[model samples]
Target: MVRVHPAPLQARLPAFSTRLLLRGVFVLELATASWGGPPVQVPIGPSAP
Candidate 1:
């Protein structure tokens, strides 16, 4: 059995938009964190897996 909570129609769009914005922010922060350390040097060779 599946049950769903009923939400007011007006709240749906705002909630979706807020979730999208938050996901974007999270991705940006993750990318910046990756860049915070010294860059890695990759030896020239066959493409790395």
Candidate 2:
């Protein structure tokens, strides 16, 4: 047996936002290193098993 599903737009939006946020963070880091700004760290999580 198996199941099929389709992710809704609302669900997809968070994923899209997360990806964009990561890109933005990278740019922020570069700017901080070259231009100077407060550092920010978004921790991911603990080690996996």
Candidate 3:
């Protein structure tokens, strides 16, 4: 029989990084919205597969 194991911190590192990246984007968007600047173009890095 196969047993399932919970993921460890090392395996979750990517998820943590992704969350941080999203948070950064959110903050940037909020800042731009508040500033009311002329349509600033934010370059998002390549997405993960």
lDDT of 2 by residue, 1-49 (tens): 7764556877899999999999999998888876676554545567433
Q: Report the alpha-carbon TM-score of model 2 versus the true structure.
A: 0.52
The lDDT of each candidate is 0.78, 0.78, 0.81
RMSD of each: 7.1, 12.3, 11.8
Residue-level lDDT of model 3, residues 1-49, one tens digit each, is 9976657866899999999999999999888886876765655677433
Per candidate, the number of residue pairs that clash is 0, 0, 0
Structural similarity to truth (TM-score) of each candidate = 0.52, 0.52, 0.53
Error of 3 at 40 (Å): 16
Output the number of the lDDT-best candidate. Answer: 3
Clashes (candidate 2): 0
Sorted by lDDT, highest first, which candidate order results? Answer: 3, 1, 2
**lDDT of the structure predicted as candidate 3:** 0.81
Q: Roughly what TM-score does model 3 have, to 2 decimal places?
A: 0.53
Across residues 1-49, which tens digit of lDDT does each residue of candidate 1 receive?
8876666656697998999999999998777766875565565778765
Q: lDDT value for candidate 2?
A: 0.78
Pairs clashing within candidate 1: none
